[model samples]
Target: MKKTQSCPPPVRRAALYIRVSTEEQAKKGYSIPAQREDLEEYARTNGYAVAGVFVDEGKSARKRYTARSAFMEMLEKVKAGEIDVILFIKLDRWFRNIADYYEVQKILDAHNVAWKTTQEHYDTETTNGRLYINIRLSVAQDESDRDSDRIKFVFQNKVSRGEAIFGNPPLGLKVEDKHIVPDPETAPLVRELFRHYESHRSISRAVREVGEQFGRILWLDGTRRMLANPLYKGVYRDNLTYCEPLIPPEEFDRVQELLKERSIRHNQTGRIYLFSGLLVCSECGRKMAGRYATTKRKAHNWEYHLYRCPTAMQYHRCPHRKEVNEEKLEAWLLEHIQEELNAYQMQWEASASAPVRPKVDKAAILRKLEKLKQLYIDDYITLEEYQTDYQKYRGKLDAEQPKPQRPDFDRLRTCLNAEFQTGYTAMSPIQRRDFWHSIIKEIRLNTENSPQILFRV
Candidate 1:
């Protein structure tokens, strides 16, 4: 027989997964590049082909796999049969969550995939190895939990000592030597905002006037938060006196009373907004809130129900300042109901026939927003650029997505019939409100005071 030529074994493809949480990087000096180099060397020494490297920087191994984009992508590649095995530096680097590890391991098992840690020896093929892996996972998770408890204790101690926490100080204050001190530039504006709100007792008016006077962009929610914040009264958490008072305690107390009183009055109002939660502002993609406009005509007060963009009125960031009269909108809807229904049916059919679109990753977008805020605080980008990018990302967050349920077309048709019109007209204000809410999803109001109705369908 002729001598058989020797053939080398096929090289297995390996995917390297690396992760370093912020705390780990700071405390343990865990480096991604170093891990990558070591993993590549391990692969080379094992006679394996390095298929890909996935790194999740500033991400904890305990986080959900979905939240770790790189890890999720690696799983996708494994599912595609591109990866024979996954390699990490240590067991802790692979997972700090036992449940999450098993959840991912199920997928790996189904795909006949395996994972190995270069610095640790634990194989799934043997009972002892599997038990050792479980013990390591438990230890890692316990360590993470303990680390969290310690950090919380430290923060609480700092707060009790009237020291600033490790984050950006609120607006109108700056961090100085681990203490919060007034920023001369914005402190005066904060004082003015409180004084204005105290005197006027109107958050919207105060925010608008203060923003205009100081050339600053003040949002309604932020302004309200500032007014109610105990920090302004030299108190933080339960510390009683955290810093120098921006607004006197008496003034702050009085403003709190005004805010509470206004809120009670608003809640107890007799007026009912027919489309309170069903109107959207076309310009800013924010909800259009209902308000009443009162005028004195012939010595008698006339109250008109209206819907307007609260974002524009309160934040002054949006340009859609025009208000839509509720009566006119109702009349317009009555006249165009048939046409709108037909158009909606066509659109619904078209959408049903079209291919499904991938979902937008809302959690990822929120994480990005937080990162952007941190970047702005670090002075890595200018205010204008930050504002522009912030708005762009916010718009994406506000964009409409597909709804799960279709509209009740049969009930809608019945409600629109001439015979049912009489019954609808006879319904009380509350009943009408309920009926409209049950059938209409939203109505987009443009700057021209026109309404674009979107039915529940």
Candidate 2:
């Protein structure tokens, strides 16, 4: 027992992590070479055997470990117990997001691995040291948020001016002198696409025709978007562009009218339900959709069409007991609508004899144009807000300026009255559904009880 006791050598294995973002490559002391040298010297001074050197170049610390390959590989080695400690150049070089830092740090703590920064000396074994690191992480996170906001504000300011934030313009245009200008070569093709859509009033047919003739593959969505784009008419987001117009404004307006009418026709379905997209479950606040179930009665097949909460039917999230028959729902809605129509008719009759107010054609185009200029002058709103409002008002002005072909009010009134008088029996299911959609916003159904219906009018 008097002999000298021999103790095992201390574990000195360490993994060094270094990160440098794209913008930090040229910054002082943040280059890959500088970070490597500093980490190597720190390891040597501390008597640590460098097990591995993980460097994430052109990668932001704001990103998680999963997004950084080098960082993830380093974590794997730490988990394997190949490294006793992890060393980095600085706190920000380690992590910017506190949540991600805590998540990875939890794993490291479980593996009994210690982490330290060469520049910032702190004992990872102590509570006060961790508190100090957390405070620094909070500062880094706040700085990142502020930097993000500043970048956004600059981008928005540029966009508000209707100047090209990005160098590339749309297919038919090019960025010239920091503004969008029509490209002579592609502009003609854009016009031809719009003309094709206008003639056929079918996006698929237009795409097919263009693809066949031009020897270029054209998609239905691309053709549709080209037809609807206002840039062809020398306007973008309500602001007149510096580019030359590809198509006349009147032609664009006519195309829009055709598109709107076509869209309405597109939604017309043969099998129409009175309450689709209007039904909601009261229990789970989920949309109730049409469901079909079959039963056998003495060798004959019987089918039941019902509305059920999708959450309950698919996920068993709520009680699966709530359901309503389609026929019963339609009957209840028809009865309710009849009462509303009667009240509406009475109100119309009472107001019929009142003096008719002279309709004024509000020159909204001129008014909105002036208001837009005034908004810029007064600085009442940001340039982005002003531009958004200007575009909206200009659209409204254009739509309103064109006086509608006056119809005989008495005849129109008579037709509406006839439709109202016809009631549910005389109308098609599609027509009834459309009528309900126009007036009723939603219908909430509870388990085996009367539904709560909300009407807009």
Candidate 3:
């Protein structure tokens, strides 16, 4: 018999992941092309076959992993068993969040795939290596957080000085030397829109007329937002003169009053919904709105109050199309209010008996304060950052240490002891609305039109 020739092992396929945030791209040798070159060279030296190159430009590793398109694509390749390994220039290039790293690591581990950084040594198989990787990740995350704080501080200072931040300016405005100025072309149209809306008092009509006259289609929501924006009146944040005014302050104020007066929620229909904002649709998790319908029965007109999912009624997206009658809902609650009260009372007693005091690591806060001071001294952080962090940590340490105190449940106990139905019946419509709002956090309406109450008490 001829001896069987043994087949050689398959070559390890490597997926190269390159990422660079806008800030990191300005640094030396941190660009996407530079990272790709290094990772490809590393893969070749390790005798691994190059599978594919994935690049996510202007994306922060500190951001959610799913937000990075290339990163997610690499994960899909790994899941499909098309890639045997993932290579990057450094662990920070892969992930700055330890939790996100572990979450993706689980998928990689299941596929018998591994990751390696060309410039950083991390071995997941060894305990020490894993701990080191975690420490490095934490350090990277701290650096990212500090960078974010510094950016926010700079932006805040700019806003205080009435300087525009990086982004497209809103409608009727243009950016000039990092300052917001009126766009001569769109400013006139915006002024016309506001004046037309003020006279007509109809967003739909204003949008249609403005789009027809200016040849620019204005979205209903965007138009509403523009009408309410303080920037149109040269006010941004707390700065009253952030930009050149497109609409006068008095005109802006008048438009705001008109908006409030024309709002559907503020319309006086002489009908009060006891569970106006309390009812939630179980299907879409949107608030159920109250509406009324009139029906003629035995030559007399009767008005029926009903609660239905607004998403289903307006957008037709929710599956729950059935309307729940307010009378039936009240009856159901009256029947079960005693039971809910009893359960809440028991919960209250248990919590009161053993109050839980907040646990704070005072030592950890002190250590952070010391580290912050050291960072400031070493010029790693600016004076503003040092002062902000110092005050924040000091406030955490000096604020009145929270003491456990039992909540007063006297009102709840009284409700539980009395006939809740009788008291609920005696209450007026407005009183009933306030009462339901006070006790019930939400009333979820299921597909079967069944009411499930979530009580705050």
Candidate 4:
């Protein structure tokens, strides 16, 4: 029998992995060098050549395995059977995900490479050794999942209570130990903007003109669009969630009314509405009471009522005691309303992912997207959106490509659309909640004297 030369001195090519998430990086004992030294010394003492020590300093293991560059490359090597063992200070240091940790171990094991955590004193080659690592990874992963869930739970609780999280506080705030404190500087600007906007129904030039008064201001059209963001009023939202407005219906209706009238040329001070605030006295600025006078019309053969300034009749010296006839003003206002509403550019939807025909599993699509998200925190969707809509279109083209004997396009789309409609209807209650969370865009009420339509970023 061949002795097999003691299995070529156990091959002994080792890969060392060290990681410190954002929290661990802030702490002292969890230093990278200390872990690296301990891991490297353990490898050397165990007759293993340190092929390379993988150091993923300041990376989150809550993310998938491939996110850490060194660890990813190390996995590729492990799969190639280039390393005898993958070493870590402990199981969590290796991977906080059992799915990823054991998955990689299986790849290593299949390629005749063994994974050994020095501190744990286990090797994957034996069944008893595998059991120790199974428990270790499972516990580590459970803790990691729990920690992530706990953080998310805290954030959700804050949101449910209408608290701000992790952003520049709305125009009225300054950060105070993770809470929003009203800022004397920015608060007044916000108030004035809201006041003027509510009165005028103009957001086009208003945002730019108002922001220019400040030393530092956000002039981006997108940021300008946020002027009407309800989150500033303290709200939280998530995707497709629904919640009734906390504000009075009248106040909310008033804001909505303002958004409808905004236009690009609205800020020009050429015309003013005399009818505003029930027609004030030209001299005293007191609100004039409304009165109706019936008149006989000639050619059209009609009776008409007109509103006159009551204060004018009350005071004899008033020069502006004019009664504006209804027909003309009604026509004028209708024209204005028509013009404003018609002035809206067509709302073009960038193709709904170029139609994911036949394989109409929206759930699968969402799951795949989630997986992609786990692989990369930021996705091609955003990058594609930023780089070129054409790139997204091209991606849609790929997604839209027809496969042989796939489901009928129309039928699949119908089914999917029906499901989406059902979901949308169901989501109405939570829409308000989701709106606060996912939508970073501002929904400005067009402060122009137009109808109540909203402008969104």
Candidate 5:
């Protein structure tokens, strides 16, 4: 009698995965209901029990694998041996990128978890099937890239013609017949913004005053944007009038110059920091935010100020654990800054007699324009090519022309020295903040090295 061999039991548990990119949400056959119905029928016929169902809606597969919340949860369950196989509608539905597919394939292989598509014949059980899946993924990724490029080209052409392709105009403007126009109610607020900023020459003060009058807390950034934005002058990013004017162009230009003159460095916040947004963790490169702590002791209660990174505060997962003692750090910074400033002042005195160089690179641009003309004269290019190249160089030359420089060093040095002479800590918080902003460009902190204070050149 011949010995009979018993067959191994078939795998029964399965995890169903369905995904729909934002662009495909309206398409037929990509609907969640259709996918669920097809996948369930396939699972029933294959003698596999539905262990779990994962769906990622309006999510792009082009993003990192970990970004898909449902997919990640399914992967975790697969690794734990709760599911024997993963079933999807198609390989492209799983991933368009080949690199991401392989990374996931390696994980599935290690855990002995097989993956298959209900609609496609490619299987992970054989070598040829795996190769076929890779080829299909490569084609999918190429198509995705081409689609992205087409969308970008269309957007750029629309913007070049000064057409508002995007929906909704920013705060003070409204879309009227596909054109950007000022909102009657909000337009007055925008005009008031410029007038208030021009008078005060302070972003924080303007925000506070305007916010109080309007019965809302106006943001500092919004006020600054209103002052600097060319939209108030009826212009867009390309510096041409694409919308109706709110403030006169002359008034807008004057406000910009005034803003530059009043900039106490880039420090716009009313919140005072002794190190002035300079403290950063060397290990993680995150800024160390200033914080105060109170600890109760047996003898006496203690109050301490500290500068700590997001990692130490449980906001980030970085490994750097060091916290800066605010009092000690501030003392060190003030002393070092004073010494650096004295040396910088001496260097400035030495260079006072030196000749000033032209700020704009006019000569270089003019030379390029001459060379471009020679190319056209020598018939090296067609009339259309010459005209296109000529316009490109001309635009560069126009941009290279000199503009006014601000926060005049002469004025800054005079103001800073007068304030410093009165004693560093003696000045009011705002005055001290302004003084530091004028002199110190940045301050970097490290647990291993001394605090590094970079002064304005």
Candidate 6:
């Protein structure tokens, strides 16, 4: 027989990964040098070449996977088949949760990469290794449970001492040192906002003028958010947990009552009133009532009934009474909207200075104004492009930055294009609903001529 040559053992190029959550600092013994030294020596002894170390330092393991940049990058390279093995000091050094550990293990296995640890030795490719890993994971889970109990104890002790653990101080309130201190720069403005809202009545009237957060003028939605914020009342609300009050909810409660008073004064409820008991019959003095309402699905709601007085339609009869179908009434209202738009267009045309088109790059403005920071990792654009766009966006973000108009009809047109691409015919239903409520008042009809729609002031 010919002499048989000895074959070399397979080379294992391993990447070391280490993670230490807040609780592990005490229990897991997750020191940077200690983990590195153990993993490095373990890789060398196992005939594996140590390539690189990925460390997720001081980050919570419970956090989303993407939150740990190095961990995520390690997975990417593993899936790319760059590393042949992953070595860690121990199983807990690898992961506290079974789901996360298994997910990463499967990815490494798919790429033909093996995973091992110094204390909990598991190869994943072998049944014995898998059994060892299962036991190690159970032990790791026990450690996690103990760590959680310790944290809860500490948190309860803190709460007992009246040491406030409010998530974030409200605007116009700064954490000077540790305790929340009133910010002189914006406190007065906040107080003024409440006063203005109280006196002005409608939130709409005070939205652009409310001197809140250092004279910060608000749009309708922003103003609503500010008003609804419980922090202004000095109460710290972290979801449902109510902590010590900061300002005093009573103050805001009074302001809310004032707002209701103003709303009633303006008679600006969505409900419409035309000839509301205004045209009383000369005969019996029973007030006339409107009983007709129409919906698009089934036109004349009044087909079943009429708008004649309940007394007139029923037992009590009065002269000068006429009945009309609510469905026909609603259709006539649509025609009035077209008429009003035509009249407004003619009036604008007669004006000497035509409303000039806005200079804002509507598409670019909206795209740049988006919450780019939130989409940082999800967006796959080049880093250079992201930086350039972010800088451009930040420069324009300053309130002092010169801008004549925020958005115009041109931007609305762009919005339409974007909406159509998602297999929708028009803007979102939300957009349509908001547009109608903001631009036009309720359509009015007394079962007579066309509808007369009053536009918003």
TM-score of each: 0.51, 0.47, 0.56, 0.44, 0.55, 0.44
Q: Which pairs, if any, clash in model 1?
A: none
In the range 111-157, model 4's lDDT, one tens digit per residue, is 87766666666656579877877887788777877677558746754
Model 3 over residues 320-346: C-alpha lDDT tens digits? 999999989888887777687667667
Model 2 TM-score, 2 decimals: 0.47
Highest TM-score among the candidates is held by which one? Answer: 3
Q: Rank the candidates by lDDT, best first.
A: 3, 1, 2, 5, 6, 4
Superposition error at 35 for model 3 (Å):
2.2
Kindly list the per-residue Cα lDDT of model 6 for residues 192-228, writing each as its tens digit. 6666665444577566665443456567776666676
| Models sorted by TM-score, best on top | 3, 5, 1, 2, 6, 4
Flag regions of model 1 displaced more than 4 Å.
Answer: 1-11, 193-212, 216-240, 244-457
For candidate 5, the per-residue lDDT at 79 reads 84
Structure candidate 5, residue pairs in collision: none
lDDT of 1: 0.81
TM-score of 5: 0.55
Which 10 consecutive residues of model 6 have the lowest summed lDDT?
399-408
Better of 4 and 6 by lDDT: 6
Clash count, one per candidate = 0, 0, 0, 29, 0, 6
lDDT of 2: 0.73
Question: How many times do residue backbones clash in model 1?
Answer: 0
**Cα lDDT tens digits for candidate 1, 14-45:** 99999998888878867888889899999999
The alpha-carbon deviation from the true structure for residue 270 of candidate 4, after best TM-score superposition, in angstroms, is: 28
Instruction: Give the whole-model CA lDDT for all candidates, comma-separated.
Output: 0.81, 0.73, 0.81, 0.54, 0.72, 0.57
